[model samples]
Target: MDRKTELKEKRKKIVAGLEETYQKLVEYKRYKKSPLIIAKNGEVLEIAPEEILPTTPYITNS
Candidate 1:
């Protein structure tokens, strides 16, 4: 295959791998009462018993 085709294929593979890894992250879930802190200057994420990882991100492009 041509270099251009090879580059495209590599890009596709990388995107797929990233997508797969992103999906597997543990923070994608509904939190009934997860602890958090409101800050005056900046937002604060209170530490949970465990890091809140879910199946997906809070928002997704597609």
Candidate 2:
């Protein structure tokens, strides 16, 4: 593989790993009934675990 293709593959792996980690974090928060703290529009907000939507349809590897 060329350098560019190798870099792209590495980036994809990194993104997939990050996404999986995020899902695990969301699951942990839900299990503990904890709030998810996030920043939106320069404001910090605490979202309930029940209100957390954990998945995005951006990367489909299959």
Q: Model 2, residue 62: what's the lDDT?
A: 35
How would you encode candidate 2's per-residue C-alpha lDDT over 1-62 as one tens digit per residue? 99989988998888888889889999999999999999999999999999998964455553
The most accurate candidate by TM-score is 2
> Quick one: how many clashes does candidate 2 have?
0
List ranges where model 1 is wrong by over 4 Å: 26-62
User: Model 2 segments beyond 4 Å from truth?
Assistant: 58-62
Q: Each candidate's lDDT (Cα)?
A: 0.54, 0.88
The lowest-lDDT stretch of 10 consecutive residues in candidate 2 is 53-62
